[model samples]
Target: MKFFNEESDFFGLTKLKERFYSSDHDGLSEADREYINRIKGQNPFGIISMFIGGVSFAFGPIYVAFPIITIIFCFLTCGTFDREKEDNPWTFIIGFCLALIGLFMYLRGVVHELIV
Candidate 1:
């Protein structure tokens, strides 16, 4: 199994092969490969988050409609962290923190509007 660096624009299989065999490469074992495959098979929370966010933005003020969309976005963002923790702990932490921040901001904005 070969891992392609998606960051690069060049999509040649030769380049991918070279990267796979490069000295800087630290290859994964079969177990690691299986784990990655499992992660890929699992639900992607980022997709859910963006979908909810888009709905919320399109439908107008959250205060006017049911808060279900906002709630779903929060849940999905948190789920993203949970899903990422096994393989990428740092990403899990960062994503979780950012999600929390977004939730807080939304709540604060709602409260501020009500108070004013």
Candidate 2:
């Protein structure tokens, strides 16, 4: 069975593999190369998705797909967190919080519909 299509591996595993192996190391020693490779920047796409998803959640149940997309983006960008610290950590923090709020809002809306 085809569990994942081609893009799945490309967007997820391939990008992660490239990040791990593609460190600039010319005059630097092995240790320096390793150190540099260990650090990574946050994925801009993930940040954007979280922000947009959070905003979309405010629109109500009709736009439920937005929060789900945000969750997917969160998983896809999970690799970025492996580094020491992300750039502009507050963006991700705020985005993440908003995403959670969005998710809760979506859920609450769903439950309200089911109960009423």
Candidate 3:
């Protein structure tokens, strides 16, 4: 199924696929493009997600909020990085995995607490 019509771009949330989103990259070299995208800075959500994921993995037994927040930040990181330069949001991906592990640990701690 179809959730949204073809005429709409999910309320402009989805972008139409193209070679390049901006005309600035049309005549530039690969190095230039990379430089510009880098100057734009990394995705904040991704950075935060990674940091929080680490914290959750370390202290998940203390609180449930950490993993939940990390998961949210990981998903929110989509489309924040430049794809044209072959940039991968590995930080967010790793964060997502770490958060899942943290969540598992959290559940284990909860079970252990209950058993004791």
lDDT of each: 0.41, 0.57, 0.63
Error of 2 at 8 (Å): 8.2
Q: Rank the candidates by TM-score, best first.
A: 3, 2, 1
Residue 87 CA displacement from its true place in model 2, Å: 2.4
Q: Give the per-residue lDDT digits (tens) of candidate 2, residues 2-69.
A: 33334446667547545654656679988987787567665554567567655655643456666666
Which 10 consecutive positions of candidate 2 have the poorest summed lDDT? 1-10
* 95 Cα displacement, candidate 3 (Å): 0.9
Instruction: Write model 1 residue lDDT over 1-116, tens digit each, in one string.
Output: 11222322233433543353344325988787666546533223444444444444433243423234455344433433333323433432333344444455456664335433
Off by over 4 Å in 2: 1-9, 12-42, 82-85, 88-90, 110-116
- Which pairs of residues collide in model 3? none
Predicted structure with the largest TM-score when compared to the true one: 3
Runs of candidate 1 exceeding 4 Å displacement: 1-43, 66-68, 72-80, 83-116
* Candidate 3 lDDT over residue span 39-112, tens digit each: 53444546767888888776665677888887865665455455544446887788888888878988876523
The most accurate candidate by lDDT is 3
Which stretch of 10 consecutive residues in model 3 shows the poorest summed lDDT?
A: 1-10
Residue 54 shift from truth in candidate 1, angstroms: 0.9
Q: Identify the superior model by TM-score, candidate 1 or candidate 3.
A: 3
Decide which is better by lDDT, 2 or 3: 3
